[model samples]
Target: MRRTITKFGSLAAVSMFALALAQPAQAVQAAGATGTTAASSSAFFEFTDGTDTFVFKLTDSAKIQQARNILSGVETENVGVMGKVVKTPAWYNSPWKYQIAPNSVSFFGMAMEVCDASISYVDTHLNEVGGALLPGSTWCPWQSKLTREVTAP
Candidate 1:
């Protein structure tokens, strides 16, 4: 799928991808040599758009750190770009099962915030997602705020 890389997104993606590519062969082998699947390193962030609350599971360590900063007041921005919305149970236990696509996280500070729509709009219009509701499979609640870091089971 085509990704929307606005401003900082491109730089972040490039650097992360480059870092993945630069990993030493030995390191890769050592990871696989264990014969065990990597333990789930996923982190969940619970956010609210005033009325509704939702959670996003982030597997990228960098993105997790960004969320931490936002929650700690270190980051002044309150808006963030969410990943594609899926029709499956959320990574955490909640009435809202829909979640942002994994690894598609982008922090605040963008001219065009695709996920600036409301949570109700996105939930009720799941059928229209990717076409009209949230173009490019991105969702950014304009007033989204990180309430807390959810402990993943």
Candidate 2:
């Protein structure tokens, strides 16, 4: 009787261990080829000046890196407008041109949105300011307007 009981207990323990080992493999098989990949995220920003609207989509890491590189060199320039020279500061230049305001980064998965303030030079005399140019006076110093973040789908 004692021998029989010992054999039964050993068999039970072995069966439990085998069952535990089989579960993970079964799960992996159920997941299949599509289930093993990781999720992707993206980031972007939108701007409106009560007239026109602009949206920037940062969908890739390269784009994010490029934006960061562009923000590092911020400066001003003088451009000709209707035969007249005008001093205009270029926002989003090399450095500090892309101003990431404090506490503006919002994360959604691997993506994040960072509040930023940027500007571009324009020739007002020609009535042709390239792109969606926002005047410096429109945004308040304390108010946060820019959104830079990653998004996921």
Candidate 3:
């Protein structure tokens, strides 16, 4: 079930208030997590305009970081462009948060914020991620995480 927090509480309710605030924060990380499975093992991002598609295959953390820098305007050069992944979406990934690079992603050669619908779709497909991201490592932003999906026991 969903939860919420309330305000205007008396001193006697300090502990309860704290707990309420903490609950939502703790749950946010898992908000859209439907679970994960090892569908793909590489890191990549895909963009499509329905008729045509583009793929940017990322080899290592540096390239991924470069892309992030480009989005944040930290890097003046577009050195983040790695090898072309493919003309059509063709990877399979699990449904989970793969820690996408920070900043608005690309679409049809335009720079704009990625829609939640795209994030959700790509996250689940990873393999055929229609648009958005492929499987991303946790080690991003300066480190890495295994891009493999988590399976239920």
What's the lDDT for all of these models? 0.72, 0.34, 0.36
Taking the tens digit of each residue's C-alpha lDDT, what string does model 2 give over 19-94? 9999878876765655651113344444333333323344345445444443343211211001111133223222
Q: Largest lDDT belongs to which candidate? A: 1
For each of the candidates, give the backbone clash count.
Answer: 3, 17, 8
In TM-score terms, candidate 3 sits at 0.25
Deviation in Å, model 1, residue 139 alpha carbon = 0.6
**Residue-level lDDT for 77 in candidate 2:** 24
- Regions of model 3 farther than 4 Å from truth: 1-42, 47-53, 79-89, 92-153
Best prediction by TM-score: 1
Q: What TM-score does model 1 achieve against the real structure?
A: 0.69
Candidate 1 on 103-150: residue-level lDDT in tens?
677776553665577777777777787886678767777677789998
Candidate 2: Cα lDDT at 144 = 22
Q: What is the C-alpha RMSD of each candidate to the true structure, in Å?
A: 9.6, 20.0, 17.5
Runs of candidate 2 with Cα error greater than 4 angstroms are 33-153
